[model samples]
Target: MPYDFGTWDRNCNAEQSQPLTGTLTGTIPSWLRGSLVCNGPGLMKYGDHEFKHVFDGSAMLQKFTISETGMTYTSKFIKSFAYTTNTEHQQIVVSEFGTRGCSVTKGFLSKLGSKFQFDKMFSDNPPVTLARFGGAYYATTEAPFLHRIDLDTLETGEKVNLHKLLNLNSQCPHPVTLADGATVNVHSAVGPLGPRYEVVKFPPTCPAGADSVFAKPVKLASCETRWKLNPCHMHTFGLTEHYALLPEQPLTVDVTAMVANTIKDKPLIEGMEWLKDKQVKYRILSLETGKELKLKVKSESFFYMHIANCYEEADHLVFDVTTFETPSLLHQFKLENLRTKGSALAGEVDSGCIRRYVVPLNESVKAAPEENLVKLPGAQATAHRQKDGTIFLTSQKLSDVAYENPVVNPAMERKPYNFFYGISGDMTSNKASVGKVNVRTAEVTRWDAPDDVYAASIAFAPRPGATAEDDGVLLVHCVHAERRRVSLWLLSAADLSDIASASFTLATDAPRALHAVYMP
Candidate 1:
């Protein structure tokens, strides 16, 4: 079924900065005193120059502050050099993933004048997901730039160029911030030594008075990748208490193609290719030693963008990740494609499912090719040692429903957790509902949305003095464009029941966001 995602493509208003009061429909927990800050594409067009892809929109920071009185809304376009320059010329000036920045007033959007290379036309649009680089929070894409923002003031602050401090040309957008105030992320560098993928750690910095945390990275654990010129795309990686799990999928980014495409005035995704013959490998980097374990673990090719949860046992390394059997996901989110087929493709859309894979970290043991190495009870996944010294991994589906943006409690991260929450959907339907999955019971629960409404990514916020892992709230952003309204639905994580919904019908520039974080 084709699902129309036109409602999710909302544009920013004329205001540079403004706080709007939103109407509340239900009671907000008095103890829930914080903000749900979201970042995503908020501006799709500039004057006559319209963006060509879904990821090319101007970055905007939208906030929903929860107070004792009621819920309020505010937003600000990230004041990056790209945004300012585009606003100054009233046209698209910087190139993005699938959009070319060209000088054209009235013409085909993709056929604009060019000769804009990737490095020369590099953009500072960090509209994907927001994370703490070190001292402060910054809006981050997969690029080398982090656009800093003040959560309270809705203000864009100093922009940091990450490439200046390290040999990193690009950093993965999903930076996993651990409970100890440290951040674990991966960066890829391509130079004379071919390509080297490194797992980096950013020690927590005092956000109060620290001027710069550029030197906060204590260690860079380099992991070996399969490709040299065309490294696999690293949109996300999994982390455990002891190691960073780096996945090398078959979907690779062709650097030569990207530069060539840019010269031809084409979008960036054109440079990406899916090598069907390649097998996926999960490389382990020991956090304690700050070194790669050099494990030869390979599995059948599968494409993924998010990992739900991961933890390490004495003998096995277990992790849950959203998987797709095909690499067609790369082209599914194009604006033109979404207009027709829409964005309703679920996990099973093409063998898309949440899979839990278990690997035997103790590589010394000898086992037959048919012998399953997983010892945990009720375990369906297998780790069999091949004759070629490769431990092959095979996984079975964990749930029937799709947990696209899988998130676990912050406290339970890098540890064993039973329940995880995310934007869930049915395989036969296009509409999305927030879902919670229980790993032990093999049960899935969901809070479906009303008709004519869209629910975005869901985040797990733990309650104060929480007892259980699911004892908290789930924050999700929903948009009903036909009604000119947006809302924040707070659901009890324990039961998936709606506690309250704060709806804003004031046209307060609340667009559907990519990801959200709950700060209390």
Candidate 2:
């Protein structure tokens, strides 16, 4: 069955406050108590105009509260200034990462005048990640600010600016929480001279100070490069217990081009230039000492959105990531092309695979051949060699499965773990399903939804008092394309079997989610 794009497009409005009353299949777990919150772009169109990129839509927050007796569903749009202002104007006045704003009037003067409206550049649409920090719920994007959401009511709160609070300009949507409750994140800023990245730590509670309404950030590590451009458009970085790995790809950001594009009223995503000749640079920083080591690796020019997990094993640092060969995956998200071309041909979209890269920290006893020992060019480090004198960065292709929105067992994060779960499907197929992969064995188990159903990302809800790593239920958000309904499926993590399901009816179809979180 083909996907109902028209139905999806119509269902992009703000969800009502009423709870979805529906039937429950099987039985609700008596121990289950908490909320599963998912964030994504829900409003694709504004009055007469539609967003050019799928990511340009305003954010929507969907909350599913699981009680002992049953589950209730509700959703609301995050009331960011951008969302409210656009709603009041009945048009997309704010400039998004991929969506440029139309000038209020014609000519170069109007365009230049619009560029001065820096307020329009702030897209508080926190559609990428749903995070809990400092005892508050937050919807975060790649932007510098964090939009607070009330956990009880799912209402949007004030936008917390890290730039104002910590003097950090950009932040990763995904933040790693330590065992002691301290949260760590990476923030990057680009300037005319070059770019710099900082690793910041936040306590579990807000600190004392005028700028400390939220937790105060303590900078642990800082790195600066004089390359005259921001290398890699990084969304997330890898974290281990003792080290943080920053994989700097070749997706160079042209600061001049970005400014020119803004003045020209062009989309900022185009300002990113892919430097095909540059190798991926991994900046390994010691969490304790703040010392940094640069390791250069050779690979085909590729793009990665998220790092699954990273850990230190003796003298080796191992990490797994979802990789893409090019930015063509973005082209596949154009709604106009999807409507005209149809999604059946999307199988040809090869976005790459999940691979693990192992980097050796120890020095190699064997020396490089005289012919191979070339001068270190530019700022690039010579590829580290293994003990056997081979190029040290060894990569293993774990699986051919093309999937994203990956999550591992929460308890096993920053440590060695095996299983990983995510939404799985071919690029062109609308029939998505939940899949689990055993990283150690490359064994994959999947649960496919009905032909008319599409599964969003899966969130692992760890069972209370569970012993084993996989002892939990996988919570999946599913959407019925033609019927225009949505449901949450609770599957057994041991086998991916449907343990229970709760279906609900909505006034409009829910947009596909980018990520979700289970709070228990």
Clashes of 2: 1
- After superposition, the stretches of candidate 2 with alpha carbons farther than 4 Å from their true spots are 1-11, 103-114, 190-193, 210-215, 225-227, 365-392, 428-430
lDDT of 2 by residue, 270-387 (tens): 7878777766777878788886865443444578888888887666667788887776666666666666666553654664677777666664446553322223222122334544
User: 461 in model 1: Cα distance from truth in Å?
Assistant: 1.9
Q: Each model's TM-score?
A: 0.92, 0.91
Best by TM-score: 1
TM-score of 1: 0.92
Per-residue CA lDDT of candidate 1, range 266-309, in tens?
77788889999989988888878878786789888888888888
Cα displacement (angstroms), candidate 2, residue 113, comes to 4.2
Give Cα-based local distance difference scores for all models.
0.77, 0.73
Model 1 alpha-carbon drift over 4 Å, by segment: 103-121, 206-211, 340-351, 425-430, 481-483, 508-510
Candidate 1 has which clashing residue pairs, if any?
347-352
Evaluate model 2: give its lDDT.
Answer: 0.73
Give the count of colliding residue pairs in each prediction.
1, 1
Backbone-clash count (model 1): 1
